[model samples]
Target: TLENIHELALGIELAGVRFLWALRKPAGTGNDEELLPAGFEERTRLRGLVCTGWVPQVTALAHGATGAFLTHCGWGSTIESFAFGLPLVMLPFIIDTPMIARAMAKRGIGVEVARDESDGSFDRDGVAVAVRRVMVEDEGKVFATNAKKLKDLVVDEGRQEQYIHELEDHLRRNKDV
Candidate 1:
Protein backbone atom coordinates (compact mmCIF):
# COMPACT_ATOMS: atom_id res chain seq x y z
CA THR A 1 0.00 0.00 0.00
CA LEU A 2 0.95 3.67 -0.40
CA GLU A 3 0.70 6.65 1.91
CA ASN A 4 -3.07 6.14 2.01
CA ILE A 5 -2.25 3.70 4.78
CA HIS A 6 -2.30 6.66 7.10
CA GLU A 7 -5.77 7.83 6.08
CA LEU A 8 -7.17 4.31 6.13
CA ALA A 9 -5.67 3.96 9.57
CA LEU A 10 -7.53 7.12 10.57
CA GLY A 11 -10.73 7.12 8.45
CA ILE A 12 -12.06 3.92 9.89
CA GLU A 13 -12.22 5.73 13.19
CA LEU A 14 -14.89 8.17 11.92
CA ALA A 15 -17.01 5.52 10.20
CA GLY A 16 -16.86 2.95 12.99
CA VAL A 17 -15.40 0.35 10.70
CA ARG A 18 -12.30 -1.71 11.43
CA PHE A 19 -9.35 -1.12 9.08
CA LEU A 20 -6.10 -3.01 9.21
CA TRP A 21 -2.86 -2.74 7.27
CA ALA A 22 -0.70 -5.73 6.49
CA LEU A 23 2.88 -4.66 6.00
CA ARG A 24 5.25 -7.13 4.44
CA LYS A 25 8.83 -7.79 5.41
CA PRO A 26 11.52 -6.59 3.06
CA ALA A 27 12.71 -9.22 0.64
CA GLY A 28 16.00 -7.60 -0.39
CA THR A 29 15.80 -4.17 1.11
CA GLY A 30 15.55 -4.19 4.90
CA ASN A 31 12.75 -2.41 6.82
CA ASP A 32 12.50 0.85 4.92
CA GLU A 33 11.16 3.30 7.45
CA GLU A 34 12.08 6.15 5.13
CA LEU A 35 9.16 5.20 2.90
CA LEU A 36 6.71 5.83 5.73
CA PRO A 37 6.18 9.20 7.34
CA ALA A 38 7.67 9.95 10.75
CA GLY A 39 4.45 10.24 12.79
CA PHE A 40 3.07 7.05 11.27
CA GLU A 41 5.16 5.01 13.69
CA GLU A 42 2.58 5.60 16.44
CA ARG A 43 0.05 3.50 14.51
CA THR A 44 1.86 0.26 15.24
CA ARG A 45 -1.21 -1.01 17.08
CA LEU A 46 -4.16 1.25 16.28
CA ARG A 47 -4.02 0.41 12.58
CA GLY A 48 -3.43 -3.26 13.16
CA LEU A 49 -0.22 -3.00 11.21
CA VAL A 50 1.22 -6.46 10.87
CA CYS A 51 4.84 -6.80 9.85
CA THR A 52 5.67 -10.44 9.37
CA GLY A 53 7.68 -12.63 7.00
CA TRP A 54 5.83 -15.91 7.26
CA VAL A 55 2.39 -15.43 5.71
CA PRO A 56 1.96 -14.96 1.99
CA GLN A 57 1.17 -11.40 0.95
CA VAL A 58 -2.10 -12.47 -0.62
CA THR A 59 -3.39 -13.82 2.66
CA ALA A 60 -4.46 -10.45 3.92
CA LEU A 61 -6.19 -9.59 0.65
CA ALA A 62 -8.15 -12.84 0.71
CA HIS A 63 -9.24 -12.40 4.29
CA GLY A 64 -12.87 -11.46 4.87
CA ALA A 65 -13.65 -7.90 6.02
CA THR A 66 -10.87 -6.43 3.91
CA GLY A 67 -12.98 -3.68 2.42
CA ALA A 68 -10.40 -1.92 0.27
CA PHE A 69 -6.77 -1.66 -0.77
CA LEU A 70 -4.34 1.21 -0.67
CA THR A 71 -1.88 0.13 -3.31
CA HIS A 72 1.17 1.39 -5.20
CA CYS A 73 -0.49 0.55 -8.55
CA GLY A 74 2.04 -2.11 -9.42
CA TRP A 75 0.71 -4.66 -11.91
CA GLY A 76 0.95 -7.67 -9.62
CA SER A 77 -0.69 -5.82 -6.76
CA THR A 78 -3.35 -4.45 -9.10
CA ILE A 79 -4.23 -7.97 -10.26
CA GLU A 80 -4.36 -9.19 -6.67
CA SER A 81 -6.45 -6.24 -5.62
CA PHE A 82 -8.99 -7.07 -8.31
CA ALA A 83 -8.91 -10.76 -7.48
CA PHE A 84 -9.71 -9.83 -3.89
CA GLY A 85 -12.44 -7.36 -4.84
CA LEU A 86 -10.91 -4.56 -2.85
CA PRO A 87 -11.28 -1.08 -4.27
CA LEU A 88 -8.08 0.90 -4.20
CA VAL A 89 -6.55 4.13 -3.09
CA MET A 90 -4.19 4.11 -6.07
CA LEU A 91 -0.88 5.87 -5.52
CA PRO A 92 1.67 5.50 -8.26
CA PHE A 93 5.15 6.29 -7.02
CA ILE A 94 7.56 4.78 -9.51
CA ILE A 95 7.90 3.23 -12.96
CA ASP A 96 4.49 2.02 -14.17
CA THR A 97 2.46 3.12 -11.18
CA PRO A 98 0.88 5.99 -13.07
CA MET A 99 -0.16 3.78 -15.95
CA ILE A 100 -1.70 1.15 -13.73
CA ALA A 101 -3.50 3.81 -11.74
CA ARG A 102 -5.04 5.18 -14.93
CA ALA A 103 -6.16 1.70 -15.98
CA MET A 104 -7.66 0.89 -12.60
CA ALA A 105 -9.34 4.27 -12.51
CA LYS A 106 -10.94 3.45 -15.84
CA ARG A 107 -12.19 0.15 -14.47
CA GLY A 108 -13.81 1.97 -11.58
CA ILE A 109 -11.88 -0.20 -9.19
CA GLY A 110 -9.66 2.59 -7.83
CA VAL A 111 -8.90 6.30 -7.62
CA GLU A 112 -5.53 7.93 -8.21
CA VAL A 113 -4.02 10.92 -6.50
CA ALA A 114 -2.84 13.85 -8.53
CA ARG A 115 0.89 13.58 -9.05
CA ASP A 116 3.27 16.44 -8.68
CA GLU A 117 3.46 18.23 -12.01
CA SER A 118 7.20 18.41 -11.68
CA ASP A 119 8.70 15.71 -9.43
CA GLY A 120 5.90 13.17 -8.68
CA SER A 121 6.60 12.72 -5.00
CA PHE A 122 3.41 12.70 -2.91
CA ASP A 123 3.27 14.51 0.41
CA ARG A 124 1.17 13.67 3.44
CA ASP A 125 -1.68 15.96 2.38
CA GLY A 126 -1.96 14.37 -1.06
CA VAL A 127 -1.95 10.96 0.49
CA ALA A 128 -4.69 11.95 2.93
CA VAL A 129 -6.96 13.29 0.19
CA ALA A 130 -6.60 10.19 -1.96
CA VAL A 131 -7.25 7.82 0.91
CA ARG A 132 -10.22 9.84 2.19
CA ARG A 133 -11.69 9.92 -1.29
CA VAL A 134 -11.53 6.16 -1.58
CA MET A 135 -12.44 5.41 2.01
CA VAL A 136 -15.20 8.00 2.53
CA GLU A 137 -16.26 9.66 -0.70
CA ASP A 138 -19.38 8.74 -2.69
CA GLU A 139 -17.43 7.79 -5.77
CA GLY A 140 -15.36 5.47 -3.63
CA LYS A 141 -18.47 3.67 -2.49
CA VAL A 142 -19.47 3.15 -6.09
CA PHE A 143 -16.02 1.83 -6.93
CA ALA A 144 -16.20 -0.63 -4.07
CA THR A 145 -19.59 -1.83 -5.24
CA ASN A 146 -18.33 -2.35 -8.77
CA ALA A 147 -15.20 -4.08 -7.53
CA LYS A 148 -17.23 -6.57 -5.54
CA LYS A 149 -19.44 -7.22 -8.52
CA LEU A 150 -16.37 -7.95 -10.61
CA LYS A 151 -15.00 -10.21 -7.91
CA ASP A 152 -18.17 -12.27 -7.85
CA LEU A 153 -17.80 -12.83 -11.57
CA VAL A 154 -14.19 -13.88 -11.18
CA VAL A 155 -14.79 -16.21 -8.24
CA ASP A 156 -18.08 -17.77 -9.25
CA GLU A 157 -17.85 -21.52 -8.64
CA GLY A 158 -19.24 -22.50 -12.00
CA ARG A 159 -17.02 -20.08 -13.86
CA GLN A 160 -13.94 -21.03 -11.94
CA GLU A 161 -13.99 -24.56 -13.33
CA GLN A 162 -14.69 -23.32 -16.80
CA TYR A 163 -11.86 -20.83 -16.55
CA ILE A 164 -9.44 -23.51 -15.42
CA HIS A 165 -10.43 -25.80 -18.28
CA GLU A 166 -10.12 -22.97 -20.74
CA LEU A 167 -6.71 -22.06 -19.43
CA GLU A 168 -5.51 -25.63 -19.72
CA ASP A 169 -6.87 -25.91 -23.23
CA HIS A 170 -5.25 -22.64 -24.22
CA LEU A 171 -1.92 -23.70 -22.77
CA ARG A 172 -2.06 -27.02 -24.59
CA ARG A 173 -2.92 -25.35 -27.83
CA ASN A 174 -0.11 -22.86 -27.45
CA LYS A 175 2.50 -25.37 -26.29
CA ASP A 176 4.67 -24.58 -29.28
CA VAL A 177 3.40 -21.19 -30.32
Candidate 2:
Protein backbone atom coordinates (compact mmCIF):
# COMPACT_ATOMS: atom_id res chain seq x y z
CA THR A 1 0.00 0.00 0.00
CA LEU A 2 2.89 2.32 0.69
CA GLU A 3 4.18 1.72 -2.77
CA ASN A 4 0.96 3.06 -4.25
CA ILE A 5 1.24 6.32 -2.38
CA HIS A 6 3.87 7.62 -4.75
CA GLU A 7 1.94 6.54 -7.76
CA LEU A 8 -1.24 7.99 -6.30
CA ALA A 9 0.55 11.20 -5.55
CA LEU A 10 1.95 11.33 -9.03
CA GLY A 11 -1.42 10.39 -10.36
CA ILE A 12 -3.08 13.28 -8.66
CA GLU A 13 -0.51 15.65 -10.02
CA LEU A 14 -0.75 14.15 -13.48
CA ALA A 15 -4.51 14.36 -13.40
CA GLY A 16 -4.29 18.05 -12.48
CA VAL A 17 -7.20 17.88 -10.06
CA ARG A 18 -7.42 19.71 -6.78
CA PHE A 19 -7.00 17.39 -3.80
CA LEU A 20 -6.50 17.20 -0.05
CA TRP A 21 -4.36 14.19 0.79
CA ALA A 22 -3.89 13.08 4.41
CA LEU A 23 -0.61 11.22 4.31
CA ARG A 24 0.97 8.94 6.91
CA LYS A 25 4.56 7.79 7.18
CA PRO A 26 5.35 4.68 5.22
CA ALA A 27 6.11 1.47 7.11
CA GLY A 28 9.72 0.48 7.77
CA THR A 29 11.02 3.85 6.76
CA GLY A 30 13.43 5.69 9.03
CA ASN A 31 12.66 9.00 7.38
CA ASP A 32 10.38 11.41 9.17
CA GLU A 33 8.09 11.90 6.19
CA GLU A 34 6.42 9.52 3.80
CA LEU A 35 8.30 8.91 0.54
CA LEU A 36 6.04 10.85 -1.72
CA PRO A 37 6.79 11.28 -5.38
CA ALA A 38 9.71 13.62 -5.86
CA GLY A 39 8.69 17.28 -5.98
CA PHE A 40 5.06 16.27 -5.82
CA GLU A 41 4.25 18.98 -3.35
CA GLU A 42 5.80 21.77 -5.33
CA ARG A 43 4.36 20.48 -8.56
CA THR A 44 0.87 20.34 -7.11
CA ARG A 45 1.10 23.33 -4.80
CA LEU A 46 -1.49 25.39 -6.62
CA ARG A 47 -4.08 22.63 -6.72
CA GLY A 48 -3.39 20.27 -3.83
CA LEU A 49 -2.67 20.12 -0.14
CA VAL A 50 -0.75 17.16 1.25
CA CYS A 51 -0.57 16.82 5.01
CA THR A 52 1.69 14.45 6.90
CA GLY A 53 -0.51 13.61 9.89
CA TRP A 54 -3.76 14.09 11.76
CA VAL A 55 -5.82 15.92 9.18
CA PRO A 56 -9.32 16.95 10.12
CA GLN A 57 -11.14 14.85 7.51
CA VAL A 58 -14.61 15.94 8.54
CA THR A 59 -13.72 19.57 8.30
CA ALA A 60 -12.02 19.11 4.97
CA LEU A 61 -14.99 17.23 3.58
CA ALA A 62 -17.41 19.85 4.85
CA HIS A 63 -15.62 22.64 3.02
CA GLY A 64 -17.34 24.08 -0.05
CA ALA A 65 -14.45 23.41 -2.39
CA THR A 66 -14.12 19.71 -1.47
CA GLY A 67 -15.19 17.40 -4.25
CA ALA A 68 -14.54 13.66 -4.35
CA PHE A 69 -12.83 11.45 -1.78
CA LEU A 70 -10.07 9.06 -2.79
CA THR A 71 -10.05 6.37 -0.13
CA HIS A 72 -8.69 2.91 0.65
CA CYS A 73 -12.27 1.64 1.08
CA GLY A 74 -12.24 1.60 4.87
CA TRP A 75 -15.80 1.48 6.26
CA GLY A 76 -15.54 4.70 8.22
CA SER A 77 -14.05 6.48 5.25
CA THR A 78 -16.82 5.16 3.06
CA ILE A 79 -19.49 6.39 5.48
CA GLU A 80 -17.81 9.72 5.96
CA SER A 81 -17.51 10.31 2.24
CA PHE A 82 -21.15 9.52 1.77
CA ALA A 83 -22.12 11.60 4.77
CA PHE A 84 -20.68 14.60 2.97
CA GLY A 85 -22.16 13.61 -0.40
CA LEU A 86 -18.73 13.18 -1.96
CA PRO A 87 -18.25 10.47 -4.56
CA LEU A 88 -15.61 7.85 -3.73
CA VAL A 89 -12.61 6.74 -5.70
CA MET A 90 -12.06 3.37 -4.08
CA LEU A 91 -8.50 2.09 -3.91
CA PRO A 92 -9.19 -0.96 -1.82
CA PHE A 93 -6.15 -2.48 -0.11
CA ILE A 94 -7.41 -5.63 1.64
CA ILE A 95 -10.02 -7.51 3.68
CA ASP A 96 -13.54 -6.04 3.73
CA THR A 97 -12.37 -3.21 1.54
CA PRO A 98 -12.91 -5.22 -1.61
CA MET A 99 -16.43 -6.09 -0.56
CA ILE A 100 -17.32 -2.54 0.38
CA ALA A 101 -15.73 -1.23 -2.80
CA ARG A 102 -17.76 -3.65 -4.87
CA ALA A 103 -20.96 -2.60 -3.13
CA MET A 104 -20.23 1.09 -3.50
CA ALA A 105 -19.41 0.63 -7.18
CA LYS A 106 -22.64 -1.28 -7.62
CA ARG A 107 -24.53 1.45 -5.83
CA GLY A 108 -23.11 3.96 -8.33
CA ILE A 109 -21.44 6.11 -5.71
CA GLY A 110 -17.88 4.90 -6.35
CA VAL A 111 -15.33 4.15 -9.02
CA GLU A 112 -12.57 1.62 -8.26
CA VAL A 113 -8.95 1.87 -9.23
CA ALA A 114 -7.90 -1.16 -11.22
CA ARG A 115 -5.50 -3.61 -9.62
CA ASP A 116 -3.75 -6.78 -10.67
CA GLU A 117 -5.54 -9.97 -9.70
CA SER A 118 -2.80 -11.95 -7.94
CA ASP A 119 -0.50 -9.30 -6.52
CA GLY A 120 -2.81 -6.31 -6.17
CA SER A 121 -0.53 -4.18 -8.24
CA PHE A 122 -1.81 -0.91 -9.65
CA ASP A 123 -0.08 1.67 -11.73
CA ARG A 124 -0.12 5.45 -11.61
CA ASP A 125 -2.13 5.55 -14.80
CA GLY A 126 -4.92 3.58 -13.19
CA VAL A 127 -4.99 5.92 -10.23
CA ALA A 128 -5.06 8.94 -12.50
CA VAL A 129 -7.83 7.47 -14.59
CA ALA A 130 -9.96 6.66 -11.58
CA VAL A 131 -9.40 10.07 -10.08
CA ARG A 132 -10.32 11.75 -13.32
CA ARG A 133 -13.42 9.62 -13.59
CA VAL A 134 -14.65 10.85 -10.25
CA MET A 135 -13.36 14.39 -10.29
CA VAL A 136 -12.94 15.70 -13.81
CA GLU A 137 -15.01 13.62 -16.20
CA ASP A 138 -18.72 13.94 -16.91
CA GLU A 139 -19.62 10.51 -15.50
CA GLY A 140 -18.91 11.87 -12.04
CA LYS A 141 -22.39 13.30 -11.91
CA VAL A 142 -24.06 9.92 -11.40
CA PHE A 143 -21.72 9.02 -8.57
CA ALA A 144 -22.26 12.42 -6.95
CA THR A 145 -26.05 12.08 -7.17
CA ASN A 146 -26.05 8.66 -5.54
CA ALA A 147 -23.65 9.87 -2.88
CA LYS A 148 -25.96 12.75 -2.01
CA LYS A 149 -28.82 10.28 -1.68
CA LEU A 150 -26.72 8.35 0.80
CA LYS A 151 -26.15 11.60 2.68
CA ASP A 152 -29.89 11.99 2.87
CA LEU A 153 -30.22 8.45 4.19
CA VAL A 154 -27.77 9.10 6.99
CA VAL A 155 -29.29 12.39 8.08
CA ASP A 156 -32.92 11.65 7.35
CA GLU A 157 -35.53 12.93 9.84
CA GLY A 158 -36.01 10.76 12.98
CA ARG A 159 -33.11 8.50 12.01
CA GLN A 160 -31.01 9.32 15.03
CA GLU A 161 -33.87 9.37 17.54
CA GLN A 162 -35.15 6.01 16.28
CA TYR A 163 -31.80 4.39 16.98
CA ILE A 164 -31.55 6.18 20.32
CA HIS A 165 -34.96 4.93 21.49
CA GLU A 166 -34.11 1.41 20.35
CA LEU A 167 -30.90 1.49 22.35
CA GLU A 168 -32.68 2.97 25.40
CA ASP A 169 -35.42 0.29 25.31
CA HIS A 170 -32.81 -2.48 25.12
CA LEU A 171 -30.76 -0.94 27.92
CA ARG A 172 -33.79 -0.51 30.22
CA ARG A 173 -34.80 -4.14 29.72
CA ASN A 174 -31.25 -5.40 30.46
CA LYS A 175 -30.48 -3.09 33.39
CA ASP A 176 -30.51 -5.90 35.98
CA VAL A 177 -27.94 -7.87 34.05
Candidate 3:
Protein backbone atom coordinates (compact mmCIF):
# COMPACT_ATOMS: atom_id res chain seq x y z
CA THR A 1 0.00 0.00 0.00
CA LEU A 2 2.84 2.33 0.87
CA GLU A 3 4.47 1.55 -2.44
CA ASN A 4 1.29 2.38 -4.31
CA ILE A 5 1.07 5.68 -2.49
CA HIS A 6 4.49 6.57 -3.87
CA GLU A 7 3.49 5.56 -7.36
CA LEU A 8 0.31 7.58 -7.10
CA ALA A 9 2.34 10.57 -5.97
CA LEU A 10 4.53 10.17 -9.01
CA GLY A 11 1.49 9.77 -11.17
CA ILE A 12 -0.08 12.87 -9.69
CA GLU A 13 3.10 14.76 -10.48
CA LEU A 14 3.24 13.41 -14.00
CA ALA A 15 -0.34 14.45 -14.57
CA GLY A 16 0.76 18.02 -13.82
CA VAL A 17 -2.04 18.57 -11.36
CA ARG A 18 -2.09 20.37 -8.05
CA PHE A 19 -2.95 18.15 -5.10
CA LEU A 20 -3.30 17.78 -1.35
CA TRP A 21 -2.44 14.38 0.07
CA ALA A 22 -3.22 13.54 3.68
CA LEU A 23 -1.16 10.52 4.54
CA ARG A 24 -0.87 8.21 7.52
CA LYS A 25 2.07 5.92 8.18
CA PRO A 26 1.89 2.17 8.27
CA ALA A 27 0.93 0.80 11.67
CA GLY A 28 3.72 -1.65 12.40
CA THR A 29 5.75 0.98 14.26
CA GLY A 30 5.05 3.90 16.55
CA ASN A 31 6.29 6.47 14.09
CA ASP A 32 3.53 8.64 12.67
CA GLU A 33 5.74 10.50 10.26
CA GLU A 34 4.92 9.41 6.73
CA LEU A 35 7.80 7.92 4.77
CA LEU A 36 6.94 9.18 1.31
CA PRO A 37 9.55 8.74 -1.38
CA ALA A 38 12.57 10.91 -0.84
CA GLY A 39 12.32 14.42 -2.26
CA PHE A 40 8.73 13.79 -3.23
CA GLU A 41 7.72 16.87 -1.32
CA GLU A 42 10.41 19.20 -2.59
CA ARG A 43 10.05 17.89 -6.11
CA THR A 44 6.34 18.65 -6.14
CA ARG A 45 6.75 21.78 -4.07
CA LEU A 46 5.10 24.08 -6.57
CA ARG A 47 2.02 21.87 -6.98
CA GLY A 48 1.23 19.70 -4.01
CA LEU A 49 0.80 19.15 -0.29
CA VAL A 50 1.58 15.88 1.47
CA CYS A 51 0.16 16.29 4.94
CA THR A 52 1.31 13.47 7.25
CA GLY A 53 -1.49 13.03 9.74
CA TRP A 54 -5.21 13.33 10.34
CA VAL A 55 -6.97 15.83 8.14
CA PRO A 56 -10.33 17.47 8.62
CA GLN A 57 -12.37 15.70 5.98
CA VAL A 58 -15.66 17.56 6.43
CA THR A 59 -13.95 20.91 6.36
CA ALA A 60 -11.87 20.01 3.35
CA LEU A 61 -14.90 18.68 1.52
CA ALA A 62 -16.90 21.77 2.34
CA HIS A 63 -14.26 24.13 1.09
CA GLY A 64 -15.05 25.92 -2.17
CA ALA A 65 -11.64 25.05 -3.56
CA THR A 66 -12.08 21.29 -3.23
CA GLY A 67 -13.12 19.77 -6.54
CA ALA A 68 -13.30 16.04 -5.97
CA PHE A 69 -12.81 13.69 -3.07
CA LEU A 70 -10.26 10.96 -3.70
CA THR A 71 -11.29 8.53 -1.06
CA HIS A 72 -11.30 4.93 0.20
CA CYS A 73 -15.12 4.58 -0.28
CA GLY A 74 -15.62 3.85 3.37
CA TRP A 75 -19.26 4.37 4.35
CA GLY A 76 -18.56 7.50 6.33
CA SER A 77 -16.64 9.00 3.44
CA THR A 78 -19.26 8.06 0.89
CA ILE A 79 -22.09 9.67 2.86
CA GLU A 80 -20.02 12.70 3.70
CA SER A 81 -19.10 13.29 0.09
CA PHE A 82 -22.72 13.03 -0.95
CA ALA A 83 -23.82 15.38 1.79
CA PHE A 84 -21.20 17.90 0.73
CA GLY A 85 -21.94 17.46 -2.98
CA LEU A 86 -18.31 16.77 -3.81
CA PRO A 87 -17.67 14.44 -6.71
CA LEU A 88 -15.76 11.36 -5.66
CA VAL A 89 -12.65 9.60 -6.83
CA MET A 90 -13.68 6.26 -5.43
CA LEU A 91 -10.87 4.02 -4.22
CA PRO A 92 -12.74 1.32 -2.46
CA PHE A 93 -10.94 -1.21 -0.28
CA ILE A 94 -12.30 -3.63 2.33
CA ILE A 95 -15.87 -4.75 2.99
CA ASP A 96 -18.67 -3.21 0.98
CA THR A 97 -16.34 -0.81 -0.76
CA PRO A 98 -16.56 -2.37 -4.19
CA MET A 99 -20.31 -2.36 -3.95
CA ILE A 100 -20.28 1.25 -2.92
CA ALA A 101 -18.06 2.14 -5.86
CA ARG A 102 -20.39 0.43 -8.28
CA ALA A 103 -23.43 2.10 -6.77
CA MET A 104 -21.90 5.56 -6.93
CA ALA A 105 -20.96 5.05 -10.55
CA LYS A 106 -24.38 3.76 -11.39
CA ARG A 107 -25.92 6.73 -9.66
CA GLY A 108 -23.98 9.16 -11.84
CA ILE A 109 -22.50 10.84 -8.82
CA GLY A 110 -18.93 9.52 -9.05
CA VAL A 111 -16.35 7.70 -11.12
CA GLU A 112 -14.64 4.51 -10.07
CA VAL A 113 -10.94 4.65 -10.80
CA ALA A 114 -9.69 1.78 -12.90
CA ARG A 115 -7.83 -1.03 -11.24
CA ASP A 116 -5.39 -3.55 -12.66
CA GLU A 117 -8.01 -6.20 -12.09
CA SER A 118 -11.38 -6.74 -10.47
CA ASP A 119 -9.56 -7.32 -7.20
CA GLY A 120 -8.67 -3.62 -7.12
CA SER A 121 -4.92 -3.51 -7.68
CA PHE A 122 -3.75 -0.32 -9.43
CA ASP A 123 -0.71 1.69 -10.53
CA ARG A 124 0.29 5.32 -10.90
CA ASP A 125 -0.92 5.83 -14.43
CA GLY A 126 -4.38 4.66 -13.48
CA VAL A 127 -4.37 7.05 -10.60
CA ALA A 128 -3.26 9.86 -12.88
CA VAL A 129 -5.87 9.16 -15.49
CA ALA A 130 -8.58 8.98 -12.88
CA VAL A 131 -7.54 12.25 -11.32
CA ARG A 132 -7.20 13.99 -14.63
CA ARG A 133 -10.55 12.72 -15.79
CA VAL A 134 -12.24 13.88 -12.64
CA MET A 135 -10.42 17.11 -11.98
CA VAL A 136 -9.18 18.32 -15.34
CA GLU A 137 -11.38 17.15 -18.17
CA ASP A 138 -14.85 17.78 -19.60
CA GLU A 139 -16.72 14.61 -18.70
CA GLY A 140 -16.13 15.15 -15.00
CA LYS A 141 -18.43 18.15 -14.95
CA VAL A 142 -21.45 15.90 -15.18
CA PHE A 143 -20.44 14.17 -12.02
CA ALA A 144 -19.98 17.49 -10.32
CA THR A 145 -23.44 18.65 -11.29
CA ASN A 146 -25.07 15.44 -10.17
CA ALA A 147 -23.18 15.55 -6.90
CA LYS A 148 -24.47 19.04 -6.22
CA LYS A 149 -28.02 17.96 -6.82
CA LEU A 150 -27.53 15.01 -4.52
CA LYS A 151 -26.10 17.36 -1.94
CA ASP A 152 -29.09 19.64 -2.24
CA LEU A 153 -31.38 16.75 -1.45
CA VAL A 154 -29.64 16.16 1.83
CA VAL A 155 -29.30 19.78 2.82
CA ASP A 156 -32.91 20.65 2.11
CA GLU A 157 -34.25 22.01 5.37
CA GLY A 158 -37.64 20.32 5.10
CA ARG A 159 -36.06 16.92 4.46
CA GLN A 160 -33.72 17.29 7.42
CA GLU A 161 -36.44 18.35 9.82
CA GLN A 162 -38.69 15.53 8.68
CA TYR A 163 -36.02 13.00 9.51
CA ILE A 164 -35.44 14.54 12.91
CA HIS A 165 -39.14 14.46 13.69
CA GLU A 166 -39.36 10.84 12.57
CA LEU A 167 -36.51 9.94 14.85
CA GLU A 168 -38.11 11.76 17.77
CA ASP A 169 -41.41 9.98 17.19
CA HIS A 170 -39.66 6.63 17.12
CA LEU A 171 -37.88 7.44 20.37
CA ARG A 172 -41.06 8.53 22.07
CA ARG A 173 -42.92 5.41 21.00
CA ASN A 174 -40.11 3.21 22.27
CA LYS A 175 -39.97 5.03 25.59
CA ASP A 176 -43.62 4.37 26.27
CA VAL A 177 -43.20 0.67 25.66
Ranking by TM-score: 2, 3, 1
Worst 10 residues of 2 by lDDT: 25-34
TM-score of each: 0.67, 0.88, 0.85
> Which residue pairs in candidate 2 have backbone atoms (N, alpha carbon, C) closer than 3 angstroms, thus clashing?
none
Estimate the overall C-alpha local distance difference test score of candidate 1: 0.69
List residue ranges in candidate 2 displaced over 4 A: 32-34, 163-177
> Which 10 consecutive residues of model 1 have the lowest summed lDDT?
8-17
Tell me the deviation in Å of residue 155 in model 1: 1.6
The 10-residue segment with the lowest total lDDT in model 3:
26-35
> Model 1: residues >4 Å from true position, as ranges?
1-19, 22-39, 48-55, 157-177
Which number leads on TM-score?
2
Global CA lDDT computed for model 2: 0.87
How much lDDT does candidate 3 score? 0.83
Q: Is candidate 2 or candidate 3 better by lDDT?
A: 2
